[model samples]
Target: MKFVIHDRNNAIKVIDSDKDQDSVVKGRFVQDVLYELASKNSMEFIGWCHKDLEDFINHDQLNSIFHHELIMASYSTTGDYEIPEAIGYIENSTTFLNVKPDVNYPTWLMSSDIGGMHAMVILKFENLKGSTKTSFDGFLNHISKTALSEGLFCYSSPGLLKKDSVSIESRQNKINLFYFVRHHYRSRWLPLLFLDYLLYEK
Candidate 1:
């Protein structure tokens, strides 16, 4: 598994050897780079666009920044939700009992809503292999369980469908799906925090 980080400009910021395959290692590397950028008051990195950190200081400021532009740009340019030629692809299982497996799983974290700083993780899988419905069920169970443990809502969409469907309604449906998922899962206080940050400051 290769780990590479790129900015909104599509410029490579960091690339590590296979030795850094651990998610924790990759996360730390990304955090280090983010802090480095924040220290310089630089929003050149994609992570800085999501939130307003005008009065935030040091580490707190770094964590608050989640740029929406970065997510849109990356997904629009390098992301291959429908096609497997670019970043990767997640297959759609036809039967309820089968779960497709992929050779590579690529994950990204970004904000899904416009002008909101909440973060969502997107995972894409490619070169799907055999399937077991039990495994698929387990996967969903695990996602739901993990989301509950973390106090966050987790949802999965059919990557193939998103690729094939291009209607405006389809796009809106996707957004709505996420909206409802978050609406049900998130605590009421989360929105209040965002509102406080947006309305009172600057």
Candidate 2:
């Protein structure tokens, strides 16, 4: 297996080789991330993106260091919501940056391969006492569009219908969503919906 690191410029370059299809992730995911998270004996660096998409892509990679100000800028209803962060071994280079956080627990979010402004959510039903990820992109989309129209950003959106989360989202949750927005533009997200629900559907 030939692992090749293709730059964003050659996102779709073709190499006529008999080495089976090269392991390449084009434009949808952060290549560096895949390289670190994926399984391979030796895959080439083949990805798609202009550059490191953190400063302005999803939630911002580092604020001078970890551009997570958007998540931090949001105010939470919960008085003591501790902000969480993404700890990509390949991204942060080290775990020492977390400092001494009050709640140092871990968090993870996964999304299906959806695209463009669409979002996935887990609807928890008190009656059923269960939760499920919905193809609810339309709902989240409407909320985001409405929120923007109301002079708000998704980061500050509450992420629910007739309820709310403890805080905007643990800083970690918000930041992770931001990262999601950055790379997977149309993938399902774990973040809550926008603040105001203008249109409700039965």
lDDT of 2 by residue, 1-202 (tens): 1122223222222221234453444543232222332233222211111222111122121122112211111112332222222323122334234433233222112111111111111111111111122122222222333334343333321221113222222222443334434443433332322221112211
Clashes of each: 5, 25
Instruction: Report the Cα RMSD per candidate.
Output: 19.4, 18.3
For candidate 1, list the clashing residue pairs, or say none: 49-67, 50-66, 50-67, 89-125, 97-133
Indicate the worst ten consecutive residues by lDDT in candidate 1.
82-91
Q: Rate the local accuracy (lDDT) of all candidates.
A: 0.25, 0.24
How much lDDT does candidate 2 score?
0.24
Candidate 1 achieves a global lDDT of: 0.25
The TM-score that candidate 1 achieves is 0.19
**Which digits, one per residue and each the tens of the lDDT, describe model 1 over residues 113-202?**
101112232121111112222121122222333343454332222221223222211012222333333443455644554455356533
Model 1: lDDT of residue 18: 24
